[model samples]
Target: MTVIRCPGLLNCDVVEVPHGLRLLAADGRSYLLRGLSADRLAEGPLPAPLAHALDRLGLLRAGPTRTVAVVGSGRLAIDVAEALRGVPGTVVAELSDDPATERPGGSWQLMEDHSPSRLTPDLVVICPTDPLGLRPVLQLCRERRVPAMMAWCGPASAWSGPVLTESRPGCQNCLDMAMARRDPLWLATAAGLTGAASCWAGRSWIAGQVAGLVAAGCDEAAWAQPTWASWTPRGHSSAPLDPHPECWWCCQSGPAPVRAESECSAVSSSAA
Candidate 1:
């Protein structure tokens, strides 16, 4: 019933459980606030990439809109949604009380459940597979046949999971595989820190990375972006487990495994 607005942003500002959204204007820019705490609102002057991403999303638009929902409603999601709000469309975010509980212990096991039936988004941005989350997302992308991007950087082994790196000149997979694999402890360390303090400071960087990947896919879906072609493996067929016609992963198919520039053209961008 109560509508509060700010700067050039549209949102509900009533702090406690936000009766509505508010938009605020500040030094030549607008911002939106909703079901958020003062601390998050104050974590201002967001990263440039993220701010650019927000501006692109139209953080100042008002009215109903079609939206692609982000699965994890973390601080990144909050910021992303705010940017989306400015757009002429909605950015529906699905939040759950417990994320860890729903996710699988093993990343692979978790991917098994990455089915479309489990979601209802025009486009879904699964958290990226960093040293922390990639294994599962990789497996899930294969199982769900969902296209995902590498959000977090990790051991080459993490990168080696199943996405498409080509072998035209050579197999980056084999190259990555030859490198020392990361210990589980490393995985934990990469995703470590799970509360507020980290969210405002460190986590945003990682989240911004993931957010960019997600938003890219969303934009591609919304606007038929051209599919970059490939000479070796076809796009989306980049999974390590995927049967490349001449993949070294399955067989020593190619001659001494030529090194392809890790462009991963095979893993074409397809967001849904």
Candidate 2:
């Protein structure tokens, strides 16, 4: 992976991405330094550097469900699968691209050739190291009228859990559009997600925390709205997702209609 210096005098932490390393600064600024040979930042658009920095901070918002499909690999995926094992009244599916890859422990199925049963899982947890890998599962879940959550636990003490769906206000696409609108560098960062540098590692406690959130969400726990939840050394925090005015998912033909129903409740009932 390529290593690069942060332009400002900011405290930067290195985290693995899909292809290369991402430098996350203390100021909530992030930059993708791709490839081992690539160094110096390329000259680009006006205010690109400033915009990239601003894209960093913010709690991700989410909503959740039941009958989960945990889409990911490595330790985190295995941990989540194991944690969800034998939970009464819930069916969990652990999917991956590789068919013959040995799973650590828990019930997992080959996704390449398997078709889900008619009783599809209503919730999907996306934790794949590759950000682009999220697309297929999300698309599949959306087609089945299911909700998907983006979850991860650290190269350090941080964890994020955000739920997404095209039919509602808190979908990942909405989050992306909102971020892109706020910062010009967001689009560029998104494009490099799959090809950027990333590593596989996280703390056990953090993983457990994420898995618990997923489970609690599925069990219809106290989280009542589309909220972004996270954990740090200090404590836990959550915030509601704000729909973008021009979001295609929330506002298709015209302005989005006022929804009396939460995304999870509405879609789960319909899918059921």
What Cα-based lDDT does every candidate model obtain?
A: 0.35, 0.50
Tens digits of lDDT, candidate 2, 61-89 = 12122567777765566666655553323
Regions of candidate 1 where Cα sits further than 4 Å from its true position: 1-67, 73-90, 95-123, 128-130, 150-199, 205-272
RMSD of 2: 18.7
TM-score list, all predictions: 0.34, 0.51
Task: Give me the displacement of residue 131 in model 2, in angstroms.
Answer: 3.8
Worst 10 residues of 2 by lDDT: 56-65
State the TM-score for model 1.
0.34
| Top of the candidates by TM-score | 2
